[model samples]
Target: MFAKTTTSLFTLALAALSAQAIITPTSPDSNTVVKVGEKINALWTVDSTDNWNDVEIQLMTGDNLQMVPLATVATGIDGTKVASYSFDAPDVSPYSKIYFLQFTNGGATTNVTWTTRFTIAGADGSTTEPENSTVYSGQTVQWGTGTLLSSVTTDGSSNSTSSSNSTSDATSGGASASTASTSVSMSDSASSSDSSTSATSESSTSASASGSRTAAGASAASASASSSNSNSGAGQVTVGLGMVGVASLVGLIMAL
Candidate 1:
């Protein structure tokens, strides 16, 4: 009886860890925001974890309605290993997007999303940044929906907004970021949430953009609306947009 009980407990613990199915790309996260029509190269670490399945990079842009599978590989190093993935620049346009890594092995599945950002341009485009929040279009950030730790970790505390606009950062699908307390500091299950958040922050800082502010907002809103359903945690956190910039632009625009 003792033996059986111990085995059961061990099995349960393993299952808990296994429940976290994922394909976490360690590079090119959403926290960073880039301009339109520029070369968008995303580097990610793919780890599908369950007995080897197809590892893939799924890029969702033009606000979720557009999904393109940039890369995939079947054979891997082991049940848990690291592999680098790079997605070539997408078609030029003025839009925002999000990204995620997926792992599928028969009946099992796992996914990890970065707090990232992206942008496409119509012309040479331009990035209009407000010098001060008090100015018109001077950085009036709008938050949206998507309930969860994203708010807490992203901003240290979760924030919510009433704006129904698709671009509201709180919404699920796109670049609109929801506000959180800015207190937590991406400290969840390290390998999963916490680590991903940190990686996203590094990427967001390097993002280079060139274009109009209004254009960015419109694109972000459209993506958020389209991504509303497909994404599990949609429109929950109310991250301020203009008043404050995104905390971390994850590797590849995990937000879009």
Candidate 2:
């Protein structure tokens, strides 16, 4: 009977140990910033004999004093006492919010949660302070929808006007540049035409001089030919007269 009673007490103690789950975070302290999807280690303790074969680790965040599960961590192991897990944070909005880890057994008993008030930085580890209201207070209040709408409209109109002015300035500058380029091209073309015209005039003047010289040379040759023809006629007439005179002298000799 004593053995049975001792065994019952030991079993009760073991059950109590299995019913409780404790988790403590060693990284990302209170009011500290940690990047989303950053790996962090956590320490947990659980009952070993209870065979609490599973435990789901989750990131908890929310407002109104009610924390909600934001992300779940796949630790991939049965809950073990004094074990460490590298938890990858979720990619959530950067806010100065209460971040915590919740370790719960697989329907074995009540769970344990540890809260760490932390800020979520950017992916590049760049930190930004939370809004003024969210900095010190836990409650989050936002501006009214109508006020936001009016501000957005005003900003949009101003941006549109600025963009239109910039575009107009750019277009005007481009047009001025195009006009300058066209003027330069026209000037070049005119210069080329003037050079062509001068060359043609010079060529024409050379042709005219050559033609005059040819005509003058032809006239001189014709004059020389006329003079030669007249000389030849006079010589022929003189020879005929000499032949007649010789024949008359021979007749006189014969008569004598």
Candidate 3:
């Protein structure tokens, strides 16, 4: 009986070591936080298997969002028994997401996943003014702020939470574009001011010169008319005097 009990204990210990399919990840650490627009390259190293003929590479992303399925990658067998895989970041993406690597060959399999959390965000792109990062009026913005732009694991098997899951509820904008336009207007303002002043000065100078010429012409015409009138009055007075003198002489001759 003692021999049988000893045998059972040895078998249990072997099972515990064989069931250890999960190992350390070569990629992002579990619970790691990443910014938006990051390329999540999930990699794994597995325990060698008896069947290398049917090795498979698989990745899964889990959150409250359903319909997103597992992905498959095809890498040929290698003598090293270690495999590497990569995926490029998309043009637009959720605020955050979860990713892990897996290896399978028939009954034999290996799993490597993060133990903590991971995150991606726009804040990684640049720092914002105190007034422009977000517009919620004092609401705290978590790393995984909402469901629309984030994801979480399911089945109650783990404690995973992303943003509220309302990707539409989130909105973002940048002052860079608006600031560029404003800069253009500011540069042109100096030219506009100079042009306005030059136009006003030119108009005033032209009006002053025209008034001076009109006043000078009126004075010349008035002087010429007065001189002609004075000459005619003098000639008329001389003619009248000659006539009176001649009549007086004729009367004296007749009396003699």
Candidate 4:
């Protein structure tokens, strides 16, 4: 009787061990939103044991025995070493729907695990309406309101590119304005210099002509008066030229 009891106890223990799941899905939780034709990774943690040697990853809907397979993600994956699989989401007609992933062991006894429900959006950003059902099935899946994939990822990059282009254009415009301003200033300086030189030349010529006239008029009267007039005229010309030089120097300083 004791041997029979021991055998029954061992059988129960084996059944309990077989009932335990070997794969625990960690990604695509209830809040996940994926788009059709987009690549996604199925990640999970392995409860390493001799119960399973290989796994089959599948996209599924429904709950428990009513679970429906939507797509096969991978097959015959080494369960002990591989913890993640990458695959593109298949294009399903009426692509907007809520779904989950199922991991099934390929061992002698099937051990299954499932991820939480997630939304799959269509190319137009449409999604399945949120329902009150907590269990994920084909028609009755629960999701949050407005749980659609955002366009920010693609729009943000385009906005960044536009901003960079605008900045570059502004910089180029500023450089051109500076160049034009410098050219105008140089031209003004040149014109001022030309005017100063012309004024000095005119003043010297007028003074020389006045001196000659005064010397000639005084010579008819007295030699001493002629010499005094000539000296006075020369001093006036020197003072006028000095004033022009000072004015030009001031203008250069102001321009700088």
Q: What order do candidates take by lDDT, descending?
A: 4, 2, 3, 1
By TM-score rank, best first, the candidates go 4, 2, 3, 1
Which lDDT tens digits does candidate 3 get at residues 165-200? Answer: 332234222355567668878867867888888888
lDDT per residue as tens, model 4, 1-256: 9999999999999988756747778997876777776766788876567344578777776544466666566667776777787666555544444577788876233466789777777866677664435553555555332222322222224466899999999999999999999999999999999999999999999999999999898776787777889999999999999999999999999999
Candidate 2 lDDT, 1-256, residue by residue in tens: 9999999999999788655534444545564566766655655555576454566666665542455665565433566554666644455554344455666665332565554556655578765443423322665532110001011112224466999999999999999999999999999999999999999999999999999999999999999999899999999999999999999999999999
Better of 3 and 4 by TM-score: 4
User: How many steric clashes between backbone atoms does each model show?
Assistant: 79, 0, 26, 0
Please give the distance, in angstroms, between residue 114's alpha carbon in candidate 3 and its true position after superposition.
14
lDDT of prediction 3: 0.48
Where does candidate 3 stray beyond 4 Å? Answer: 1-190
Model 1 misplacement above 4 A: 1-7, 35-39, 45-49, 62-82, 97-115, 121-256
Q: For every candidate structure, what is the RMSD over all alpha carbons to the true structure, in angstroms? A: 51.3, 16.6, 21.0, 22.9
Two-way lDDT contest, 1 vs 3, winner = 3
TM-score of each: 0.32, 0.38, 0.33, 0.44
TM accuracy, model 4: 0.44
Candidate 2 vs candidate 4: the lDDT winner is 4
